[model samples]
Target: MNSSRGVLELPPVVGRFVDGVGTFLADDVDEGRPIRCRFLWSAITPTSCRWEQAFSTYGGRGWETNWVMEFTRTGRDCTNNG
Candidate 1:
């Protein structure tokens, strides 16, 4: 993830990813406080997608979105690795 600050390095998140949607969860410490983090990914198109990060105070309940990112193709074809 990239922000005005810089790239972000997230901890090891574990979850399931199926089709064009994915949900990842992890436990992290923010500002010396323990919290639960969630990262969701959704595919909009072959060349576009959406990603967001949220925080939960109690497990998976009551989530507050902290960041969101949208990605689009930049004229770089990735259909073929050749």
Candidate 2:
């Protein structure tokens, strides 16, 4: 994943992308109930990527979830190859 400074480790295959992306989710179930979550990426490289995904469901559901994922290169190589 990308660091706080936005420096990506960038593996040999995917050394073309930068990290430092994040997502957020929030909701309210009842009159006084609120749910919220924040996610961050831990490592990122040109050939691979990793990040944390989290969510919180409050009030009615009272649910919380967290996850991580790794991605491999899936795109066809172009002439540029850079």
Q: Name the best candidate (by TM-score).
A: 1
Model 2 has an lDDT value of: 0.49
Per-model C-alpha lDDT, please? 0.86, 0.49
**Residue-wise lDDT of candidate 2 within 1-82, one digit each (tens)?**
3567788542222112234554433342323455454345545668777765444554324434468778777676767785
lDDT of 1 by residue, 18-59 (tens): 886899999987767788999999976877999999998777
Model 2 alpha-carbon miss at residue 77, Å: 4.3
Q: Among all windows of ten consecutive residues in candidate 2, which has the lowest summed lDDT?
A: 9-18
Candidate 1 at 6: error in angstroms? 9.2
| TM-score to native of every candidate shown | 0.73, 0.38
Least lDDT summed over 10 consecutive residues: which range in candidate 1?
A: 73-82
